[model samples]
Target chain A: MKRIIEVKNLYFGYEKNLVLEDVNLDIFEKDFLLIIGPNGGGKTTLLKLILGILKPWKGEINFYDDNISKKIGYVPQFSSFNKNFPISVFNMVLMGTIDSKNFIKKYKKEEIEKTKEILDKLDLYYIKDENINSLSGGLLQRVLIARSLVADPKVLLLDEPTASIDITSQLNLRDFLLELNKKITIVVVTHDPTSFAQIYDHIACVNRRLFYHGRGELDAQLLEKVYGCPVELLGHGIPHTLLKEHI
Target chain B: MLEVLSYKFMQNALMAAFLASIVCGIIGPFIVTRRLVFISGGISHISFGGLGIAYWLGINPLYGATAFSLAAATWIGFSKQDKMSESDLIIGILWAFGMAIGIIFIHLTPGYAPNLMTFLFGNILTVPRFDIFIISILVLVITLSVLIFYKGFVSVALDEEYSKARKLPVRSLNIGLLILIALSIVTLIQVVGIILVIALLTIPVAVAKEFSIHFKKIILISILFGISICLLGLFISYYIEFPSGASIVIIGSILLGVVKGVKKILKMKLNLDETIN
Candidate 1:
């Protein structure tokens, strides 16, 4: 597979305090990359650096493709937005088509058509006219996904896509993402890796440090090395019993 | 009411109110959605420092307010950091500091500031033709800006991080929005005075949000609400001989209360009907 992005010796921090140090990773075409870590382990910061939202203090992030900004789609946490703000699903998704070049212009016909197509593909067309504030956490998650996909990105980065949704919605979103991964590279930054188990091609455990694994399953030894503890299980709320016994 | 229009002053006041409503309504939804009410309040108050300085200089106070407001808006917007507390602290300092500057300058000015009350608690009935012209220009600028940058404004207001990730001009949009907001605050000063300007910018949008679930709709409804409230307050102030700014705010607050109360009762009724069925 062709390499899509490369992070080399990355160092980042907020003010004087450091968060991510000497981080390096390679994202390839159509790779399902799952980044997991404990809370405040610089997982989201890494995603932001890749997306160019935050600048790296040291080192470099190289994108192989030109126009990487337009090529990469981002889905932030569902709770990131103001819940009371007035916005329709269609309008919200339509905003995805807007880039820096079209800052002062109105939406074009093609962009509007593309937004509709994305909503339909996500099974959200029927509720396109509905207010976003009226949506359930799960449905809102899907709408956010639809918004990101409307831009026709080559690589999609999701920050905690399944953070607060229900089990059924989580499973449905996993399947949808799996289907999408067939078409484009998918990178998900999640603290709970078990939520998307058996789906990721590679797992990168991060805790101020990053330990990358090629296989889908991470053994207890590797988990301890990353998390700095014996890992018997990894999931949100419920125990997954997925890890092997630590020797 | 028709007799009031016969007078030239009354006509200018009405025109001022109409134009003010248009601009305020146009920009109010953004202020509401972005939760910039505090920042706007800070900007409005800071303009008073300009007003005071302008008085000391024996120049047009509006010019001073306009200059001070724009500067404060830009400074506050650019200086804002990631932490909410830090930004809030900045706003708080600027808010009182501006007012203090205004007070000190006015005190230093040799004579009594005859039009001081007009700047503090607006007298809409006394609005001059010059102020009306300025307001009309502002209305035009604000309407055109909103129309042109509607998508960018909405995107940045909703999610700055996501907009930045999309390579959208987040900084430019934010500064642009702040500039428009500062202009709106300056225009509103003649109608509501610096002390009550935030109310005129917010109350209509607050009420309009109750009726619409779309940004464009909220803006349209806010304009309508603002115009109605301003006119009604004008009429009431004319008859009852009350402070126009205070009257306007009172009417707006009452309308907001009524809308919220009525919606609550209707919701309760629906719940009862559902339970009975």
Candidate 2:
């Protein structure tokens, strides 16, 4: 696999508080990477740094792709923006087609066609004209995904995609992501690993520091170190006993 | 009402209302959707300080207001952070601080005091033709900008971070929109004044959202609603001798309440019919 992005000695903070420190990671093309951490463990901040939304206080993020802007897509947290905003499903997805070059110009025919294609693929075509405010949590989440997919990004970064959806929606999203991983790279920041169990090729536990584990079994000490407690992992096709009883 | 249109001042007032409505209609939804109502209020109040300074300097109060509001808008935009409560506190302080400054400066002015009530309560009948000319220019500029950058503005308004990820110059777009909002507030001040400017900026959009889900349609509807409200309020104030700004806001509030109530009743009737089946 070819490396696509490199994070070397990254340090970031807000005001006086340090959020992420001395972090390093390598993301390859077509890699399915899951970044797991406890609440407020800088998961979302890390994603923001990679997406160039936040500047790192002391480190460099190197992107190998010359056209990084067009090659990377981001799906922010479901609760990041107000869902009560008066916008339709079709228009919301269509906004994904805008970029630095074409923002002042009108939408082209191909861009609208691409948006429709993505909506169809996500099974959201029927409700294309529906107001986003009237959609359920799961459907809204799917809309966010569909919006990102319309950009045709080589590397897709999602922050807590399964944070608030139902179990069925979570499973469906997981399967959809798995199918997408076949064609492009995916980096997901999620605290809940159970939903994406036994699928990610690489797992990076983050808590100020990062512990990267490649394919195979994960060490219980690594989970304990990142989470500051013994975590129980329950899923098929994985180790039955994840950690010692929390005593 | 027909006889009133024959007066030159009444014609000017009507022209100002129509122009101001176009601006409010275009800018209001962005303010409402982005939840910037409070920030817009802060800018409006801060402009009062400019008005006071202009009174002291014997300059156009509208010019002073434009400069102050644009400054405040830029400051607020750049100072915005991820923590909303912190930003809210800053805006709240500026809002009060601005009013205090305006009052103090107006007190220090060394001439017969300008009628402060006109600036506070607004008299649309007294709107000069020059101010109408200014508002017309504002309406044209706002319309053209929205026409070209509608999608970009919508993207930033909907999700700032996502827009940034797409390399949409999120910071510049945000600052640009804030600047336009400042200009809108300053221009509308003639029709509604500082005390009631935010209501003029937001109320029409609130009512229009009830009629449409599409963003552009809502904007179009809001413009029409704004024009009608301004005209109605002007006529009501004429007959009752009430303050024009307050009358406009009062009419807008009642309209909103009536629309919401009717929608609720219709929804309940539909549910009842479904149960009967």
Q: Measured by TM-score, how close is model 1 to the native structure?
A: 0.93
Per prediction, the TM-score for chain B is: 0.97, 0.96
TM-score of 2: 0.92
- For residue A5, what is the lDDT in candidate 1? 95
lDDT of 1 at A42: 96
Error of 1 at B57 (Å): 1.5
Residue B21: error of model 2 in Å?
0.7
* lDDT by residue for model 2 (B2-49), tens: 897899999998998888898899999999999899999999999999
**lDDT by residue for model 2 (A65-148), tens:** 777646888888877776768888999999888888899998899999999999999999999999988888899899998888
Question: DockQ, per-model, please?
Answer: 0.70, 0.65
List model 1 lDDT by residue over B131-176, tens digit each: 7887788889989999999888988888888889988878878888
Error of 1 at B193 (Å): 0.7
> Once superposed on the true structure, which residue ranges of model 1 sit more than 4 Å away at CA?
A216-247
